[model samples]
Target: MSYDSAKAAFADWGVDTETALSKLAEIPISMHCWQGDDVVGFEAKTGNSGGGIQATGNHPGRARTPDELRADLEFSYSMIPGKHRLNLHACYLDTDQNPDRDEIEYSHFAPWVDWATDQGLGLDFNPTFFAHEKADDNLTLSHPDQGIREFWIEHGKRSRDIAAQMGAALGSPVVNNIWVPDGYKDTPVDRMEPRQRLENSLDTMMATKHDKAQMLDAVESKLFGIGVEACTVGSHEFYMGYATRKGTLLCLDMGHFHPTENVADKLSSVALSVDEILLHVSRPMRWDSDHVILLDDAILQMAQELVSAGLLDRTHIGLDFFDATISRTAAWVIGTRNMQKALLRALLAPWDRLKSAENNLDYTSRLVVTEEIKDLPYATVWAEFCDRMGVPSGQSLISDLHQYQAGVSGRG
Candidate 1:
């Protein structure tokens, strides 16, 4: 299964493997920083990861410092094909000062910006609404108290400013995403009040405008978290409407929906209202477990939708998973590579033929071709792309990952 043969086979279906690889190389997956540290940020006074967030397992080499995490990321990025961006949380600030969330300044994260610049990587950012004392009650932006709401709002505002600076430094637009864990564990008498408060806080936080080329605002929604079982203030309906009205990107986390719901389907529906989208690609495993993503049917369908619907350019694809059970760096390499593989698979799809069959209402042809194309030499094309990008695949990839893990095993 040489790449030439695979390319020829795809050519028979009117697909260009070279073009597919070219497109895939340009699309970057924003790898999350929390994965290396098990979501235990390096904040001066880091609080428990409440708000239904928990990363299980006690991997030996969990990154305990900013340098360690960056080292691990550098290694992980080395093994992954194509250039990618890094998604950072406010709590991951590499600073000597012990500033609280609301008091954080861009200076606190200047080191990260400098490092990213040196590595020729872009950056994305998030305001840490969880793992803070104010969010102990499972509420922050939508909290009943005005002071607490204002604090979170200020934090969000500062985060956007910092993200803008990062993007400006890197000459790329940084996605400043906001995901608050404001909900009630038990049923509440009045759900509208919290949502109203949340809307107000968001409006105030996003009042200041930055250059679109520098920063893009995004709001993420969740179905339900571990404790917020009864009601989640920032539900999908809430953020979708907010993003549509506010003219911001709506982040659709794959793990934020119900088990039966196909997140791939939402891309077309949401695209009608929202101009841009941010995807938090993760494996839920029945719940929002944040398991490292695999090249499964769900991910494949998502990649297909992004390509077939012509939404790739308007979408920001980011990884959102933290599994401490395995090598943290390995997790990043595996998940990021899987995402690229899925996109490559979709790119190689004979979409023109499939769409022609569907447009003509030829269900039999569509079904048969869809099923038959599954047997195409996708792996061969993927291996070629990896080789061109100077990264290993198959057994070589496994061996490289294990070697890195063994090297870093001495970390306390």
Candidate 2:
């Protein structure tokens, strides 16, 4: 059936497919640059993943240079149906002159701004708190050593400055996220000190004033990590209080929480407190593995909650996984496309009926309507969305990826 037929089908359920498609088109997913190289940033001479984040699988054709990474990203954006932004970690900065992370400056990323300008892509930034020598003993900002803490603080300051420049260049506010792996392998004798140090370090970093329109600061929290199994200093509770008191955006990484923890449930609660939020959507099998995102139940719930809470515009969505097990470009397309698909499905939901059923205490009707919407022509509408996007639908997108791999990424 044609997209027009699909539109009529959805309209029967009171869903304006046209409006949904338009809104979905405007929601740009921030694709992470680390995926193109399996989290091994361009500055890492040894390809060390550091900070308990490791990308499994040794897929061939990984981009080795910034130029190659950008080329792969160019091809990735082509396969994807809409405009997107690039999320760059501080470690990925260009290295014409080998400056350590502490000494790095926005000048190193001038080429990136030029490229993003040409591609018409927005930019997001992250401070690399791990995989560096300064991250002594699985601690960075929370380190007891004042010099090491100062080093990371300086890097954070510089990263925010670079993101501000990116926003100025791209005509959009940049989301600058900071997720440090500061914790203890075993139970620490003192937890308050580490948390206090982190708080102080963050104060120093955010003390540097920047235009709010140009750069928005956000801090991410993790329950635990590979090495830091005992406790994570920057726990959800810690960042929650800090974000509320300090007025910074809070980032919720899907993989950072426990397996049973529903990150979706936290959306409404956090939304009431913070002005804006950043979401790092990824799949976690057993831990923070950073697996590529799929159209799983967890993802569906996350999107539904975001839509139901009327936060589609207030929250910034970004992909945060490095699955080197598959074709790098395929990983990008799969994760990004699945993210769009989940959001579209949520948009098509009959929220009025669902909420009315809840208000009337009609549990039976609510459950029925919820299960019934699952069987709608979502795939049909998705294909139509691809058509509206002027990109290939169904398995046809695979062919485009294959052709690019043969002509471009495969060359690496």
Candidate 3:
């Protein structure tokens, strides 16, 4: 869909509003980018911070304290020149260093609900879980948290309930981003057990949330690491394979593809609802090359095809970068700009011509090229158009321009 059409849809849905700065805080995006259904931000959990948690690896830095997290959000708002929004981790659930008891209050995330609401940003507070639960056909459940039966079970339930309550508190929909890191290491692994538990939990929550707000079960796929041997939504086929399953959808992470896989093809193969396609956008670089790279042409082509197929409006975009040495601001800035560049190009692309090419289908030698970057109008012009129409600036088009220009000069 065209950007204009998308904004019109937002306006029609009453999602476009001039929220007070105080209200902005309530929305996760106000503090970080990628809080929208179409996008959200994640603070990659890295070990370290003097907390001795050997579960993953020696952490580079400790998770930010609640106060520190709040301060950083405020700083992010101040320093990131344009109006930006984000989705924040109420707590890093996957981190081994984080206290099991403090799972719900990771970084005192609950308190921020009020603070974020006061800031005027709607919250997309996410709680997380690993595949700790295993089931047998006899319907037996087992968890590794030892006290899982007594503590974590209730903890997980309460977490979901509180999320619903937060939705009521903020009067907005909440998304529970689930990444089941339940896999084995050439050892015992029960994949069905975790899937059942997840589905059951989602069904329970969906029944309650049907009227007031929505819950998104964003299942992130994992590779063989940390004994996380199972892949939730292993491939787009896995997602489609389990349709009618209830209360969840597939979340595609860019890095999940095979080393030499074509992302566009993966996008095409997705069997879930078009609207259910949540995205975690980042480069899947190997070795010395920084994982952060421009969106390749194939991926853009795939996205364009999806857009033409009416799937673009349903997807949410987010950053899944893991840069420890770099400042979060720099990472977020680059990440956001890359997404915009990629999306805008996809939108303005001669999609009709590309579709025709698909029939003749030759991306080999003598490929037909589209307009030069110079020919495109500044994104700010589009933003200004949205502003005139009373739609709060969707993005800082000028910032996008500069970021793009930087890439042209090899500074990006």
Candidate 4:
């Protein structure tokens, strides 16, 4: 199973292994920082920190500070192949003085900009919307209290500014994403009130324009959360229409949809309307469990749609899972590596042949060829890609990962 052998075998079926690897290198997968710390940022805690989101498992070696999280991220990045970007939550600011969510400033994140500069990584951002006094009712931007809603609106605006600063410093466009928990636990009589408030807050926050080259704005919707079980203010329809009208990226988190629904099915419709999109790659069991990603059917289908629709450039792929059951560093490595593998698998497909079969009304041949290509020596090509990228290939990273768990991760 040499690289040359795999390349020649794929070539027989109108696929170019070399081209797939090259294209994969160009796509920057944004690795999330919260995975290294169980989503607990350095912000000084006021009250209970669990804000609808839950990270199950008490894995030791969880990072407790900004420096430790950055160190863990540095090591994890070394194991994963290809150059990538880093995704940050607003709560992860590296500053001595902790500022309230709405009061946060760009200077607080200057240290992160310096680190990204040295690592050659671009940065993306999110505004922390829950786990605060204002959101005790599980509402922030959509709260009926106009004062509370305005506070979150300011936080969202500041986050965009910080993200824009990161992009300006790193010479890349940073995507500032907003996801709030505004829902009712039990069935509420009134759902429109909260949604109306959410729409107004978004209009106010996005009213002031920022440089498009420096940053991009995105809105993420969720099906449900811990408290917001009955209804969610930012449902798919709300954000979809808002993104379409406002001209922003609509983030689609895999775990946000129902158990039976495939998130890939919504890609074509979103691509047709939104200017671009941001995808949060995660593994959800029965709900938004936030499990580490795998090379499963869901991931393959997503990659296929992205490539087949020619939406690779129009989509920003970011990892969004934090499983504390295993080594956190291993979680980062496994999830990111699997995402890259899925993208490579999709890229290596013989699209010309598949499309031609579909064009000729040869349904039987198309089905047969699609299934047959699954047995191709994809592992050989993946190993070659990792080798060429100057990283450990295959399960060889396990030995190094174990060493880090004992040495570095334990120190945290």
C-alpha lDDT of all candidate models, in order: 0.93, 0.89, 0.44, 0.90
Cα lDDT tens digits, model 2, 175-293, are 99999999888998999999999999999999987888899999999999877999999999999999999999999999999988999999999999998899999999888888889
Kindly report which residue stretches of model 3 are placed more than 4 angstroms away from their true locations once superposed.
Answer: 1-63, 77-84, 92-110, 130-151, 187-214, 229-244, 271-275, 287-306, 356-366, 371-412
Cα RMSD, model 2: 1.4
Model 2 TM-score (2 dp) = 0.97
Question: Which candidate achieves the best TM-score against the true structure?
Answer: 1
Q: Which ranges in model 4 have alpha carbons more than 4 Å from their true place?
A: 49-51
Per-prediction tally of clashes: 0, 0, 36, 0
Better by lDDT, candidate 3 or 2: 2
**TM-score ranking from best candidate downward:** 1, 4, 2, 3
For each candidate in turn, the TM-score is 0.99, 0.97, 0.62, 0.98
- Selected candidate, larger lDDT, 1 vs 2: 1
Off by over 4 Å in 1: none
Model 4: lowest-lDDT 10 consecutive positions = 44-53
Task: Tell me how candidate 2 scores on lDDT.
Answer: 0.89
Tens digits of per-residue lDDT, candidate 3, 1-412, equal 4545544543442333222112222212223332111111223333221100012222222223444444445543443333444455434332334444324543345565766676654555444333122211111112333333334344555555655666666676565554433333344456666555544544443454333364455555533332333343233454444432553656666665555666556555664443466666656654112244365664465555555665654555555554434444445544554554455445544455555666776564115344432244435433543444343344454464344334323211
